[model samples]
Each structure stands twice: as C-alpha cells, then as structure tokens.
Target: MEWVLLVIAGLCSGIIGALVGLGGGVILVPVIVYLGSVGLLDGITPQTVVGLSVIMMIFTGLSSTIAYMKKKTVDFKSGWIFFAGSAPGTILGAFVNRGLDLPSFQLYFGIMMVFLSLLLLIRKHLKPVHWFVKNGRKTTFEDGTGTYVYGYPIWFALLLTFGIGFSSGLFGIGGGSMLVPAMLLLFLFPPHVAVGTSMFMVFLSALVNSVTHISLGNVPWLYTIPVIPAAYIGAKIGAYLNHRLNSDSLVIVLQIVLLLLGVRSILDGIM
Candidate 1:
C-alpha cells in the first residue's frame, strides 16, 4: 500500500515536471502529508515525511536530468559553479527540516511557493541588460562576440546558487521554482535553457543529498522507484511542448498549480 501511494506520487510529480521543469514539490509534498498522515505509515511524523520526500526527490531529479541533458539545454558552467555552495547548503537544509515542526513546515513551504511562483511570473517580463566593467567603460553585458554572458564571471551568481540549493534541500525539491526564475531574472538565461540547466543541477545535487537521506533512513525507495520511467518521459515531452505552447499561458498555469499545492500542503499540515 505504501509502495502504491509512492508510485502515484511519482507519476503525478512526473506529469507536472513535464510541464513546469519541477519534480512537483508543491503537489507531492502535500499529497504525501495527506496520504501518509492518516495512519498510512507507522511512526508518521513531519520529519519522516520530509525525509522520505527528499529521498524520492533524488530519483525524480535523476530521471529528468537525463532528458534535459539530451536536449542540450543544460548550462553546466553556471550549475557547477553554483553547486560549490549549493551542495553544502542542501546538506544543511536537510538537517533543518529534520528538526522542524509539521505545521510550520507546511506554512512556510506554502508561503515560499507563492513567493517563488509570483517571482517566476515577473521574471518573464524582465529585459536583459548590458554589462559594465569596473573600468567604467560602456561595455556590453555580453562578450565581444555579442553572445550572452555564458561564461561571464559573476561573483554574485554563487550566492544566488547557494540560496537556491538551500531552498531545494530544505523543501525536498529540485528548486526549479526558485532556480528557473532566479536564473532567468539574474543570469538572463533563456527560459528553455534555464529549465534544462536547472534540471541538471537538480539531478546531481539531489543525488548527493539522497545519500544522506538514505543514511538517515528518510527516503522511501518503494515509493520513489516506480516514477522513474514516467519522469523521464515527462521531461522530454515538456521540453518538446516548450516549442509548441505559448509560454505565457503555460507559466500562468504552472503558477496556479504550484500556489494551490503549496496552500493545500499548509492546510493539511495545520490539522
């Protein structure tokens, strides 16, 4: 029965991932609470839910990361650089979630979701800016080649990455909700490329965190295993759909979905 529920969680999350480049944290975390809280598992608690949730994210991220990589949409340099901070931050977040209360977690998680979704909506409107050097020359944000600053050094990017990683690890997500918007807003990454790169970071970073989750007995493989194939398929389809749908409508839908999921999780956790 637990296995069945986990499989459902994975499938649902995969479908959402296909659409929004997330593993469906807003959706899955709530459902996890609702389903597992009703005497579904022995010794049920918020920490247990969080632990298992983070564990599942590792696999979910791994599945989608492959698809994003195949599409050639990943931004490795930025992701790797960010991982320097994110990797450590994620481990720290896991510890925080471990010690937190249920209602507070739910409440904070929903608030964060609302915040992140709105930020994403706003990011769609931001225009790219030209770069300037300390030398005070009217230099473009791009290199002399007129391309966007892919390898352009930005010390602030690491700070942003660390923040994103912390949020992801704390919430048991890939942080696409946070990452996609941040990358788009700050780095001015193309949306498609940002989604792909975010997925890559999710996979690698979550994979590392999964080891810790397992060591602490927080992950539930029975539930996480079934969703693997579906998550992969969903990621590819989402990337394909990126070309088909008008991005505005898609993002709007994603925003609503995440908001509702976050709110629902909070409500469920409260009582």
Candidate 2:
C-alpha cells in the first residue's frame, strides 16, 4: 500500500514537473513528509526524504528532458550556462543540508515554497523590464521544430542558477519551480523553452546531488524504486501537454500549482 501510494504520487508529480519545470520535488517531498509525520512511514528522516527525492528526480528530469528534446524546445546553450553555476552550488548544498534538523528543515521548506508561490502569483507585474547586459546576443535561435526569440544576460543567469542549485541540493527539489518563473518573467524565455531548458538543468544538478546523498547513505532505495517507471511515463505525458498549451495558460497553471503547494507545505510545516 505504501508503494502503491508512492507510485500514484510519483505519477502526479512527474506530470506537473514536466509541464511546469518544477522537478517533482515540490510535490514528492511534502507528501513523504506528511506520511512520515503521521507515522505511516517508519524511520523516514529529512535526509532520507531528500535523498529519495533526488533519485526520483534523476528519472523524471531525464525522461522529461528527452521528451522536450524531441520537440526541439530545449535551449542547450542556456541550459549549460545554468548548469555551470548549479553544479558547485548543488555540491555545497548537499553537504550543508546534512546538518539540518527535521523541524527546521520543514519550516524552511515551507517558507521557500510560499515565497516561490508569491513570485509566480505576481509574475505578470514583474515582466522583463531591465537588461543587465546591453551587448549580449539578441539574435533568435531555432531548435529544429521551434524558433525562440529571446535575449538573456549570461551573467545574470549564472547568478540566479547558483542560488537555485543551492536550493535544489538543500531541499531535494529540481529548482525548476524558481528557474521556470525566472526564465519566463525575467529573461522572457518562451514557455516551452523555459520548461525544457529547466528540465535539462534539473537533470544534471539532481544527478550530482543524488550521488552525494547516496554516498552519505541517505536514500531509502526500497521505497524509491517503484516511483521511477511511473514518473518517467507521466513526464512524457506532461511534455506532450506542455506543447499544446499557450503561454498564458501555462503561467496560470504553474501559478496555481505553486499556490496550492505553498499552502499545503506551510500548513504541514507548522503543525
């Protein structure tokens, strides 16, 4: 029954992560925490949950990235730039996260979720208003099937991704919740491009972070095994759905998920 529940949760989380670039941790972490809080799962520490979540992210991120790649929506150059900053941050966060107590971890997670939710809610007002680098490349690029007309400051992206990667490593999230919104609202990336690129970055960061956690013996492999296949299938479905939705609709969907996840996480954390 526990495995069944985890599979169901993994399916839903994968779909959301693929569609919105959230990386499934937003959904999975809270659910596992809630189960453990209620005594439904034994010996499930914060470290254990974070470790398992990263392992699941490896599969979801890879599968979703592949789906997006087929549609030619991923921004490889931009994704690599983000990964450059994210890698070290992820490593540092993995080591730092080992020291947090369960309650403190939950409280911080709740606060982070709520903060991300608020950002998404007011994202429209935050539009791409400033260009930090005037001499940056302004040319449009084609990704086989789709062409993206976007300009991004490489320095700004590196700065932002470092923080995002830190959060990903520390919180066991994909960092897409923050990355997707920043790409769209700040960098003006096309919605599909942001989602795809974010997935690629999440895959790389999560893979490294997962290895770090595994070396520390944090992952509950027995419980995490069933989630991978279901999450992979769901991610493909989500990527298919992402291509069909318009930007405004996608933003609305992402905001709603962030809002709900935020509320639930906060409530769980305080209680």
Candidate 3:
C-alpha cells in the first residue's frame, strides 16, 4: 500500500521534472520530508532523500537524453566543459552536505530552489530579440538580456555556465533548470535544443554527482530503485510532448508553472 503511494508520487514527480528540465530533486525533497513527518517514509531522512533523488535522476537523464538525441539537440562541446568542473565540486559538496542538520539542509535547498523558480518566471517574459548564425553554425537565438549585438559576451556565457555547474555540484542536480534558461537568454540556444542539450549536460553532471554521493556514503538505494523506472517513463512522455508543442508561448507557460512549483516546493521544505 505504501509502495503504491510512493510509486504514484514518483511518477508525478518524473513528469514534472521532465517537462521542466529539472532533476526533480526539488519536488522530491519536499515530498520526502513531508513523508518523513507523517511517518510515511519509515524513518528516511531528508539527506537520504537527496542522495536517492540523485541516483534516480540518472535514469531520468538517460531517458530524456535518448529522446533529445533523436532530434540531434545535444550540444556536447559546451556540456563537457561544465561537466569537467562539476565532477570534483560535487564530491566536495557531498562531504560538506553531510554535516548539516535536516532543517539547515532543507533551508538552504529551499532558498536555492526559490531563486531558481523566480528566474524561470523572469525568463518567460524576456523576449528573444536577436538571432545569430555565424560560419553557418547552428542558429543561436539570444534573448534581450545583453547589449552586445553578438548576443551575450563570451565571458558572460562562460560565467553563467560555471554558475550552473556550481549549482549542480552543490545540490546533486543536473543544473538543467538553470542551464536551459541561461542558454535561452544568454547563449540564444533554441528552446528545444536548449532543453535537449541541457539534459545531456545534466546527464553528465548527474553521473558525476551520483558517483560522488555514492562514494561519500550518501546514496539511499532502497527508495531510488522504486523511483527511477517511473522517472524514465515520464521523461519519454515529456519528450513526446515537447515535439508536439511547438509554440514559444507554450514553453513560456510551462516554464512559468514549473517556476511556481519550484517556489512552492522550496517553501514547503523550509516551513
């Protein structure tokens, strides 16, 4: 009976995560905490939930990557750079994460999630004011965030990507929520491709973070096994929907809703 509830919650989480390009940790973390309070998790701590969420996200990444790969949306070059830096950082974060109490962990996680949520809401209103096609390269659409005619300066892009990687390292997320927006507003990556490629980058980041968490004795295999398959399935569903919905408005709306949900999740964790 309890397993049924867990599975259902996991499925809903997967669908939301896939649609929004998040690793689902924000949503899952809150649920785990709530479950713990209700004695639904059978004594699972929030830290265990974080660890298991990272492990489950691996399957989520695989499914989303496969869906995006079909359309050739992956940008491996930029992705690897972020992954390289994120790997070591995630290891360091896991060690640091171990010392914090439950409330402190939840508080910090909540704050980060709330900030990300607001960023998503802001991205919805930002217009794509320019398109860059240089050397016959892939079309790059830049939102109106930078004054440079060539879009955001190269240094700025690097910094934003580094920030995304840093968040991934700190939280065991793929940084997809942040990456997708950065690519859209800063790098001018097309929405579809940005989402897909972000998943790839997230995949690498998740792999690194997951391994690091496991090594640090943080992973909770018990609940993870139940959640991952459902997450993969939800990713497939989201990928299918992504191809079906071809409007900027829809994407914006979806992102906004996700942002609000992220906010809600964070608030729940904190309170």
> 188, model 3: CA deviation in Å?
0.4
**Better model by TM-score, 1 or 3?**
1
TM-score, one value per model: 0.81, 0.91, 0.81
Collision pairs in model 2: none
Better of 1 and 2 by TM-score: 2
Which whole-number lDDT from 0 to 100 does residue 51 have in model 3?
77
Candidate 1 residue-wise lDDT at 186: 53
Whole-model lDDT per candidate: 0.65, 0.83, 0.66
Displacement of residue 181 (Cα, Å) in model 3 is 0.7
Off by over 4 Å in 2: 142-148, 246-264, 267-271
Instruction: Please report, as a residue range, the 10-residue window in candidate 1 with the lowest summed lDDT.
Output: 132-141
Which candidate would rank higher by TM-score, 2 or 3?
Answer: 2
Q: For residues 157-238, could you state the per-residue lDDT of candidate 1 as single tens digits?
A: 5666677777777877667667666666555666666777776677667776666667777765555565455445555565
lDDT of 2 by residue, 1-271 (tens): 8888889888988988898888989888888888888888887888998998899899899999999999877888888999998888888888888998788788888888778778877877875743632435454657556765676677777889999999998999889989987887667687778899999999999888998999999899888877888788888888888888654676576567666766776676677
Clashing pairs in 3: 141-188
